[model samples]
Target: MPDIVEQHGVPVLVCEADGVSIGTVQDALDHLIGAAFTGAEVVAVPSPRLDDRFFDLSTGLAGDILQKFANYRLRLVVIGDIGRHLAASSALPDLVREANRGQDIWFLPDLDALADRLGPDGAGRKTG
Candidate 1:
């Protein structure tokens, strides 16, 4: 299992190679709920750790997850380069662009950027 760390006071979840699957995502969610996720300003999901199988930017799974984050008013940070995703789907760039437009969702490679987005600098930017 990938260890969970707190970066700049925000919760950052690193995905283990074996944990990058639908089943393991539940565990990640559980870990978040059990941790400081309730009041967490930012929840960073490192791209390398995510199960690419279900993270298709144009697919329902990704949409569902984003919807849930919005419903909960949670800021979700996807940390990493998404060149692969951009190559896979022609719609991915737009999808990512739209997702990032929302305060709750962001796509970036830097963990510190995630912290800033979820910190005092990006406060009160809830979707719900």
Candidate 2:
């Protein structure tokens, strides 16, 4: 189950911390759409539910998943400590850094970090 919470005044669908990794792009899409249906402007997914391949740029899984979210004009936030993956691969750290710098997608250390990024008013205003 997921939680629909107001973060920084924005509605965000926060995925469960369950350790079930998303194995395919379809699964990712399902989650995104489901979140959107709940009127969430941003979908916050815990890192524990992401497949290991998602952390490997060469697999292209991350790109595919991100594209789907972008196509729907939904913001995707991957939260949790991905330090192990980052240390294992140089590209992953770079990718996370780049994503965090953008508004469309972000990879944050935790929910608090996300709240900080969203600021005092969340992502400016609420969205459907």
Candidate 3:
């Protein structure tokens, strides 16, 4: 189970690095429902837990999963270094750049970054 923690006043579900791998759209829905039931406004998933295919934009897995999360108004943060994968693809960097600027899905370097994005001084932005 994901550990629910309050970050900057936001209910966040922090997924362990070794938790269930998110390899399919169903997996994304499962996580979304879990977060919803727990009253979590955000979910932080370790990058290692994401399937390698997730970084490959050609697979459509990333778009599908992210779209589901966005549709549900759930914020998803992918935490970890995806430097190698970013180095492997040209289009992916563009995707990451765009996602980082959004309110829903974010690709961050660490938990600290997630906290910062949510809010730095323990006052989180209202998630609606």
Candidate No. with top lDDT: 3
As for lDDT, the candidate ahead, 1 or 2, is 2
lDDT of each: 0.60, 0.80, 0.83
Model 3: per-residue Cα lDDT over 1-128, one tens digit each = 78888887888888889877889999878764465567888888999989999999999999999888878778888899999999999999999998887777889999998888888643336545
Q: How do the candidates rank by lDDT, highest first?
A: 3, 2, 1
> Which residue pairs in candidate 1 have backbone atoms (N, alpha carbon, C) closer than 3 angstroms, thus clashing?
none
Q: What local lDDT does model 1 show for residue 79?
A: 77
What is the C-alpha lDDT profile of model 2 across 24-118, one tens digit per residue? 89888776555567788888888988998999889999999988888887888889988889999989988888777778788888988778778
Candidate 3 clashing pairs? Answer: none
Task: Report the lDDT tens digits of candidate 1 across residue range 1-128.
Answer: 44556655655554443434442435445643234254555566667656575467544666666566666555667778888878888777887788676766788777666666656666424443
**In model 2, which runs have C-alpha deviations exceeding 4 angstroms?**
121-128
The per-residue C-alpha lDDT of model 3 at residue 23 equals 94
* Best by the TM-score measure: 3
The TM-score measured for candidate 2 stands at: 0.88
